[model samples]
Target: MKISHLQTRFILAGILLVMTTVVSGIWSAWTFAHLSEVAGRTIQKSQLTTDLSAVLSDALEREDDALLLAMSGDRGQAQKKLDAERLRFAQAFNRLKENLDQPDQTQALAQLAKHAALYRAAGDVLLTTVAPQDAFRWYYQNVNPALRRAVAACAEIRESNFRAMQRAGIRARDDARGATILVIAISAAALLISTLVAVMLARSVLTPIRELDRSVEALRLGDFERRVEVTSRDELGHLAEGFNRMAEALAEFRRSNLGEVIAAKETLEATIAALPDAVVVIDPDGHIVAQNPLAKAILVATKAQGAKIVDDLPFSAGSLRAVREALEGKPTDETRAELTRAFAVRLDGQPRKFMLTAVSIPEFQPGRCGAVAVLYDVTDFARLDELRTELVAVASHELKTPLTTLRMNLMLLGESAGNLTPRQQEILATAAQGCHELASTIDELLDLTRIESGQLRLSRELVDVYPIIDRAIISLRQRFEDAGVAVQVAAGHRPAFVLGDSVRLGMVFTNLLSNALKYSPRGGCVSISVRSDHNGRGPGVLQIEVSDQGSGIAEAFRERVFEKFFRVEQHLQNGNATTWGAGIGLYLCRQILEAHGGTILCHAGDNGVGTSFVLELPSPGTVEQ
Candidate 1:
């Protein structure tokens, strides 16, 4: 019960989500608790401090009235006021103590109590003073001051507690907010993981079903060329494997049982008739086992018998000796020998190329061994191969002279045109540009040869494509500006990086840009766009498309455009006649893209208007498959 990759992703995402949610919830709860405690403390301190101050103020006012009444010699009034004042002070003391949130404030409260008692005694002494002024002075210097100090002490306690509570509240709130953010981040991460997991599971289940459907469709179309890929040893993998085996077995059974097995004589006759060549088989007894229709025509045209052996035929002595050696198993490889010696046999009085191949037939009884010989006409392929080789060689030599002369002229123009007139300089510059293009064309030819010979080596690495595009444009910017072509490079996003040989990638872009610039008319736009999209399986990919408002490919020759040495024009004219180099730029581009596990294709560019070369490259993976 091995899970698919999609299933694994889904499970992983779910686990991440759950863990994040739980952790965030726990953190948030803890923060909230701390915040609540701090808020409670703050409220307690504020109320207690505020009420204590009001009570103290009232007590001070009553004491002042008592002093004034005694000074006026109103003894009964003074005594009554004194009594009220003492009672008020006592109430304030009790309330202050009650308001303190901590036991440490108890000592401060006790001190306030002692101070209040002392202040009351001092006030009584002043009220009954023999010298009234002395009593007033005593009240002012002792009782009133003592009362003020006691109130100040209580206020200080309240202030300290208030500050402590405020700080605590702030810290608690901050903690709570921080916890909430953590919870949110974790929850988001979890949600993302969950989504990823669901997607993975769906993909896992759907991928195989899709592949099965595709295979079935292929089978329906009479294509039995595909096999299901086993990505895992899971039940699905096993099922796919079994289904593939069944398809293979059925295909083989159908091939084997669809028709009866023909007799040896009939099989030989069928093989000869189906083959586009004359065929003859002879046993050791020198009797002809079989002769195809072509072989019978040959025998009749030469006035020979079809049932006779080759020794009786009008073939040369060398061919007869080779046949005799094949019969005796004396030839090399103990099988067969064939010679290209000419014979007098004719078909409609026409001479045609023939390739003779002979092999011994071991199924014959002892002392009756035989060999089968087949002839083929290979004149067309052999001639084309030879002519192509000659063309490559001749073109290489012919292009070299012009290339050298062009380089020399560029060098001379650059050196001598230092103080030339504007028109003169312009001509020289144009000539130099033409020379460079010719050199580039030659380089393309050489590159194609290297590619075909499997000599192209790629050194791959992670590369930033922007710099390559920038560099290519910089190298060709002057050329484009001079040609009056508008060259544009489209900004690319995704995979942010690509894996390739920078030099090779640069060459690819440079070639495309150059082609676009060369072919595009003045004021026409040549755009280079890079794109990347995920293939929905592994890492995403990056692609570059270079398009130009130039002549598009002909309908009939679209597929043949990438072939080496294939030019669009049948006869190269003056401007295009210098196609001295082998036409291999597009071919090389295709090879390079393919080597990077990418693809390059030409499409009908801009509504059958211009040519567009699209290149799709894989963001090379680390794991080698």
Candidate 2:
């Protein structure tokens, strides 16, 4: 129902066309009518003049005949002929005067009358006075020639009027044509003007609509900065102006919202800073962007600002190297390197051990480019760690002495009881078994401390990873069979050798295999996959993937699962679940991997329903010696 510019233009053109056509038509009609009347008058004049010329010619001929007869002395014939010609000439002259259409036409008719009367009178005089012969000669020579000349002049005047009328008709036709052309030209110009106006109006309407559309689109895309542009005072322009106002309102709203978000972010940062941990943020290029006060304190104490780990603090070189390796790039397993925390020697004291828990900062914004390093001051934890080491050391020594003495005493008691009852032998055997279990517990605890403190000495060498894997499986076979758990080795075609301590590597596999068996259901599969890095340039790194069907670690706890003493409540529920470990097991595994420039991580298993622990070790040249 809306009226478009084209329709408006069409209506205007129609109006102009009708007006021009009607005006031109009326003008042409009037001109044509006037030209017709003028043409009729010219025709009448021409006919009258043509009639007078004919009559005069006849009169002159008759007069000449009469005059000739009289000159031959035939008076009766001359008189009779003259009288008849006079009567005929008078009738012709009367007809000529009656046919004249104008007053000027009457003047030519009067001249014709005078000429005719003179010729008649002259003929009569000649008949009576000069014996008709001399008079007749005079009449022929003078009156007839005068009549012929007067009649020819009259004919010329009529012909001139006729020519004028012809020209007038031609002029009328040309005027009508020119009027029609003028009408057409005017119509064309009117149509062109209408078209231009219509186009301008359409643009006026469409431009604002398009601008509004673009503004809405930008708003949808989360850009609230756009506004509609309007240059008119029409309704559409008003709508555009309204749209711009709305955009400004929305922009103000967004600004207020963003201000709140910024405030909240600042509050969160402040809270994080208040904590005892030293937190730092790094750009993608490994440059530190933000640091909490604790970090600044540490940096000032060490004078290591703006310096890479390995370059700035040589005494703490390994510690800085570990931070770089951990936080350099992608999300990775937490890297823990042992370092010493130094204080000013106010009382001549040595530096203290502070366990460094360096974890690879995950990319907060998936595609954006930055990293975060949370530095927890584990000084107290380190002290506890040292206490645990000393306890293990002390307990090992103390338990060894008791275990050795108890074994000897149990052997003597069994030998003495050998000669007595079977009850005594049974009691002695039970006592020896108890002793053995207690000793084993002490040894396991000691091993955990040694791993945690980073004091576990390793003899690094090139050794095939499969033998260690095979040994682990064999060692844990009885435990698996007893629990009805199936254990198998999944290996690649080529041998995979790793530059690691075979004993420690075997222990890592054993710990993992034991966990897999304890957590898996009866007859469930515990697969150990081993392979070598295919490319030859790098070290022939070995990968060991241990998979088990068990309760999966929750997404939130995946990172925490490797922390020391960390245990999920579910894993501790089952009565026979040895999987609920001292939590130092996986921690030790990580520490051992880091020691050898290798890595380990826990993930959703192949079936995506269970857990898989993947261990990656340096091949050869890729290992940091």
Candidate 3:
């Protein structure tokens, strides 16, 4: 028979259920039949035994009454009554004898019949006697004893039958109970087995359906190689076979298009190889998927000796961070900004510079998305920049000695005003001022060069930052007064201490104070405050803020204000002449503070009146006594 999977399962389950029902029904019927036989036997035995006992008792009573009546009077009437009672007793005894089944009951019934015969003979003798006294004596002596013997025998037979019936009834009840228990146990076992079979069949059917669903999902996700496994010859098995065929066809189609894909990949590799820059493609997990020859050469040459390319590459930590960001789907601009910096690597014991660029590639499957990095070598440009800085430093240093000498000569000329005209003295004064300004600009340029060259070293000592701030304010007091700006110093009660070069730290405060004085309006206030705090980064930090009530710096220029030679546009509303400084003051301040592990930030002052320059310096650790 060509049974389907569903039909096969249903047939097995139905067979189990039907077998349980039929077996239980048969067992119940057998038990009921046995119980009915037991009950019928019990009832029959009880009725017969009861009739025998009642008839024997009535027969004895009737014989006693007849004997009493004959002894008193009316012998004929007594004789009739006795005959009627004997007839009834014989009928009951015969019926009891017919019902006797056990050996003991039959023997007891025979004995009872013998005793009844003797008792009837004794009664006949009493009826035939003419002497009334003799009849009475014979009835008492023979008939009474025989009647008692017959009654005892009848009781024994009835008791024997009743005991046998009781034993049969008990056996019947126990058999019925055992049968019911067996049927119930078999039914429960069948139910459990059927349930297990149904579950197994259900899993078999649903398993194929789930496999088909998974296969379809795999195909949708571009996995054409997935195939459904067929383990049966039923309808589900046929479906699995059809699915496998479809997957094979799709796989073949993919193979046909795979040639073009491989060709394109080779072309891309060739293009990347032809390029001068080093290029590497990496997956989302930071694994290198592909790399051009230049990239391989650079990474291999720059890696530590004996390190595998797969384990460690030559990409800088910053470059890797940019690639990771790209892989994480950050905007291209943000990734580019993070990567647009110079990376230095050692190649053949020589330093080489490269600029890294990371780009994210959109993926058909999001899980397969990755990034590509390109490294452009800029060693020559870096060398050129270094040379330019050195040249500026040398020129500034050379001009310093001559500019200092010129300033001293102008001061001497101004001092000897007695031998010259007032106009000549004024000219000397202006020239002296110009020489001073020139020297200051040269000094600032030299400081910038030193900082850039990494040649600046600090003479560190534990110093009070408050005094340094005070000294800077005192030095700038004259300038502050000349600008008609009030100078307020609000040093906190607690001393602020830091580990730094006193002169360099003072330079930071001086630059900030000078800018405040220069930019403040006439009669404006410039406040300098110092406090001790822990700025969450660490414990024990010294903070100094220099605020000026002047035209606040525009937000657009705030970031650029610390760049060397950058300046803010002057507005006519201020009615102040354009201030002159090399603009390196704040730049130098930033460099100096950073060298000492501190930070400087500028923001608009309260009420938007001026700019606030905040300095944060790490406080010196306390020494144990």
Candidates' C-alpha lDDT: 0.70, 0.68, 0.77
Which pairs, if any, clash in model 2?
539-619, 539-620, 540-619, 541-619
- In the range 247-352, model 3's lDDT, one tens digit per residue, is 8998998899899999998898899889988888877676777777767777677663333332365556766667777787664432223111467777678888
Candidate that beats the other on TM-score, 2 or 3, i.e. the better one: 3
- lDDT per residue (tens digit) for residues 82-103 in model 2: 7787777677766766665555
> What lDDT score is found at residue 374 in candidate 3?
84
Q: Point out where model 3 deviates above 4 Å.
A: 5-26, 29-44, 51-55, 74-118, 128-130, 166-235, 282-289, 300-352, 357-373, 387-441, 475-490, 493-495, 513-587, 597-619, 622-625
TM-score of each: 0.37, 0.51, 0.72
Span of 10 residues, lowest total lDDT, candidate 1: 332-341
Off by over 4 Å in 2: 1-299, 304-381, 400-444, 537-541, 570-579, 620-625
Q: Which consecutive 10 residues in model 2 have the weakest lDDT in total? A: 339-348
**How far out, in Å, is residue 270 in model 3?**
2.5
Q: Output the number of the lDDT-best candidate.
A: 3
Error of 1 at 99 (Å): 99
With a 3 Å backbone cut-off (N, CA, C), the pairs that clash in candidate 3 are none
